[model samples]
Target: MYASYKNLKIEVKFQGQHVAKSPYILKGPVYHENCDCPLEDSAAWLREMNCPETITQIQRDLAHFPTVDPEKIAAEIPKRFGQRQSLCHYTLKDNKVYIKTHGEHVGFRIFMDAILLSLTRKVKMPDVEFFVNLGDWPLEKKKSSSHIHPIFSWCGSTDSKDIVMPTYDLTDSVLETMGRVSLDMMSVQANTGPPWESKNSTAVWRGRDSRKERLELVKLSRKHPELIDAAFTNFFFFKHDESLYGPLVKHISFFDFFKHKYQINVDGTVAAYRLPYLLVGDSVVLKQDSIYYEHFYNELQPWKHYIPVKSNLSDLLEKLQWAKDHDEEAKKIAKTGQEFARNNLMGDDIFCYYFKLFQEYASLQVSEPQIREGMKRVEPQTEDDLFPCTCHRKKVTRADLLTHVRTKDEL
Candidate 1:
């Protein structure tokens, strides 16, 4: 899995076509003089992009999950737990996915299916049974007996033991709407509005009142309308005091977010799933720092990829002013962040992360996974199988367009 090369040519091919600069020669850490400079020159990028860090991250995330002698952690997976949590058990065996514990969360299942389906097409997946937490927060409580049990979730915290996986919203567009929503991974990237300079000068945000900081963000926007334009599209937590939070604003298109030069990413229940979309867009992301994080968050740098803001929003006003004063620097950060996402967060990278995550998890188990009684088998939904995605401009069939359009051979 680790490589030490001397004069190696790294050619990247996508969909039967050679990527623009194919065969990037690699001689140890540095490539040939006229190589893919920034990407190839940086040892971290090469190591991370190639999947070692991803594997290591998976190991670290699951470190607290207890391992038994001979390790048979797969069979030891508990059928019942004392604490009530939204979780579903799954087993990937014989190139098919089987569900042990049923979950009604379609969004989460859609994302998991995409990962398993993508992997099944490319490689024979080893039999592994794991639990997926459907809740917003990680199931592993601090200093609880849950540490002995492995649980996978969209987000994780330093104090928790849940293995962080990619958030479901990435591919949840395939749900009830029949892929009509722009929230899906492909459309989110493709429909990011105009360039940075062309966008509005103000920073914009719109979300439900899930977190108190979000409500405060809207209040801050009212006082400083010029620098910030934040509002709650829906109010739930503070419903009794809705009058103080202003009228509930109608939901806007995700593409409309890029109209502003800055995008505010405040976590709702856990780590906001919109961070990835914000990073992919042309505008700079003013991300709120929090304990919760997605799998790729560790790779992001503050002020380099995004302008980090205090979790409490106490210094948000100051951060906004600094961004306004340092327009060009802010623009560069936005560009850097966008480039990072465009390159590293491609469909292939996501699939690679999932493959390695489960692969490593499978390796740790000594028991041969089996399909539990009453478990239902889930099938992979290929491009042809997906419903036609209705776009704003036109109704487009998933088959007619590229939706995470990578082949197993490519992976």
Candidate 2:
């Protein structure tokens, strides 16, 4: 009925015949290092499940700001950003999602719809409308300003006021690869290869020159060849200084990152999207200390889930050396981090966070949401249906049905 140590596969049969869905798989709920508590223990469940804490965490993420005013956000965003291409206005009313945007943002729209659909399958989706910015940079207020614009975003810095939401790439892969390939967070976890004992001892990093510290990481690798092996796979921001940064390397599969024992996570434009994927792997993550943070960042504790390095990567070699000096302890940290991610960052958790976030956000609404003019309803598509609404395809209308009926009667 339940997994004792790890995931188990059980085959069910009725009188020597396989039953429907017979080969059922069971996964063990995440537990502490030496937890021998009963499977149905309420305290242990709350400690590991993270479902009950979702609302409290959402409240913590929004506590610094004033009460969220959806009407205020819907009115101020367009005037401030001028209907930017990466900005979208969303409204969830009567279990249907609607959007109003200036540009064709098919990917972000699809990501939002997919998550909402998944959430609706598990719980009643709360009615809420707010603005979201799909850009890499978070919003910054004026130096002496005094206003709270609750614009949702994927990432935010310490000084920013934008409300941080789970990144879209967690559900849809389009944002993960910058529109190149389709691979979600679960896919990344599946591809993380080799156990910790089988990986290379060197700390590994492969990324663009989006941040200057990344370039310095490569230089540090050159000095401490035994400890680190960082390189710029692509050089966009510092293309002119490519010669100084060393030759570019070919892009490798995300699975290749797990080949090393230590993973180096440095920020790009904001909080790097790769950090979540990195945390889920078997290798110990050496994260950079920066102002930018994702939604689940507050829960990550250094020396437990990850090792923290200075923002400028000043103590990277020292941290890597420490990991080498205490190999077993480092491996335990890796396992702890991996278990934490497995328990909290799953698709179900994402849906739970979204549902609770909107639920709390809707409760603070001062005015009932209205479907604004020019807003188009977004619905999921199906191949079996004769008429299905999709992101790329338009839905059949009542006017078209009336015209078809009249033509049939005349014929």
Candidate 3:
């Protein structure tokens, strides 16, 4: 049998307090939020703070009040939101709110949950309606079967064969709601700034192989080509200051004339072969055994940078062959290699996107009536604010105390 359409409006109540007010009926008394805290903390915080004693009492009193079971709520949020969409909510405690659909494509579930939470907390009796655009096969079928019914904006074209509709793009009203919720969440999370925000550029590059060894080798080649070549070849030659036949030119077949004419060979080996040198300024310099391509190329003149040097031919062929044989391995290593710096750190962009979405969602306008109703239903309790708690205390505040104690004790 199809689920009854009692105009499903979920009212999220905290503790026993009615936090949200709307005509739409809510499913349960529990709510869920995405947070940085571990499962234990998340569970404990919600059980203790979000569902305070007072709010729990009110939840019991209401016949249609929604319940917030942590595990069940967590399963309802979406993993990602649209570019214009945000994930923020005005939850009772400092926790994240995540909502998604049930049974079918729950991609937007967490976002929807956040929207609901925000509406209750920020907006006052908002005439909001939830909607899903049926443009995909599964979704369209689900909608057709009455598995997922439209709660808002019933006007849609039936001729369109798409499973999801173009109108699925987050509307301005939704975005506005998200913006308000995001601000509230941000206020609770606090601005510690980015993990790499306080670090200097040099510090950021300190341990990076690209910055240290590769860059140093390039600079060394530019400054003293002959010295570098001599070191690599275990032979000393007269340092020449001409740009025409760089240390590298001796190895290339195109520059064979110059090599033979100058007798620029060490023992039986060609000078370029004996010593792998990249051209720097007007001459060629010794090459270092660094693993980055950019650093190796940057040492050469811009016009000649792409030109193949005899010294690197063997290495290039080896790398190319290896890449062909083990493409996945090469990709894995490349990704791993990128993790040494803040700029190329893994998941940086994704986290930034999440942060931005959080900000936008926090700024949404939750209905004031809902929040007031929730507040009115729940009684206030004298819980410990714990300004002196170790986890919540500030070092600066302690320093002030130390100064006062030291001076007062001395007096």
Candidate 4:
């Protein structure tokens, strides 16, 4: 059933617009100032601090697999954030999240759960919506207001003051990890010889001219064509920088990435979403340093898993030459990166990371009305009593702490 709150009035309805709309959402909570809803502005801060979109995810997952409880933990709202008994809790069948923003965003919204794997409506939005930021080519100009919640984009700085959910891509779900990236890695590795053996010695990079650093990388390719093979995937996106990106190629499939010896991983938008997949391959990834990083980046080492390039790529050609000259060392780095992804960065890691992060946030939830008390209740719609099949509670317990501290194995 649709999540309709008595308090939430569905302000507007768009007909056939999801087809026209772009799918990518941004890094932080987005607020729609144009939507003059009554209850939205007052509860805006809580929306920023928590991932209410997770409720949609939980509902969808429970609809499919009824066995998974996903370990719930409760917290009182922190004094720094609020003092009210306004509990910012995440539970199955019982989540009380005010949908911060709603639109035809694909890549950027909350994981809501693995439900994106099943449902067409990406979000069954709460009436109380937040901002809807368009993180496109040119950054949106910051509005002149004190309550500024700038989107933390993939290409955005990680140090921004805006409150955001634990930074992650929706692909972190098991569906993409096993069905998409992992399968692609396996197929590519199986079809091709090792990076040191049959791969081309030239440094290869394929992506849109989304960022200046990427355009510059393509420019470097012209100077040393023998060593670098760089091209734009869509030069059409280039209006002002057409001359610089004119020579770039149209597109490269994900499977074709393994054909090269050195795969140049650069930042796009905010972080390189492909880097995680690239690291799983045999190719030596020459990654450029950037302020933006994904959820799992801290677990990786620059020179250990993949070679780090300078921010400006001043040594791009030199780095390519060194890899060509020292093929074995480059292969070693490639092998290490593959192993790191295989052993550490799995679908389980994504679940656990979000699990822990949510647990911490739950602990600070305001504890007044408690679970269902004082809160408005719906008939609790679903095909079955599937949501949060186990372990949702009105009070904190020791079991919550144990789950929080333990790793996947411990859990």
Which lDDT tens digits does candidate 1 get at residues 285-367? Answer: 99999999988898899999999999998898888889989999999999899888877666657766776777778777767
Candidates 1 and 3 compared: the better one by TM-score is: 1
Please list the residue runs of candidate 4 whose C-alpha ends up more than 4 Å from where it truly belongs after superposition. Answer: 1-158, 161-173, 177-195, 366-411
Model 2: clashing residue pairs? none
Candidate 2 residue 292 C-alpha distance from true site, Å: 0.6
Identify the superior model by lDDT, candidate 1 or candidate 3.
1
For each candidate, what TM-score against the reference?
A: 0.75, 0.77, 0.18, 0.56
Worst 10-residue lDDT window, candidate 1: 32-41
**Global CA lDDT computed for model 3:** 0.25
The per-model lDDT (C-alpha) reads: 0.71, 0.72, 0.25, 0.50
Best candidate according to lDDT: 2
The prediction achieving the highest TM-score against the true structure is 2
lDDT of 4: 0.50
Task: Choose 2 or 4, whichever is better by TM-score.
Answer: 2
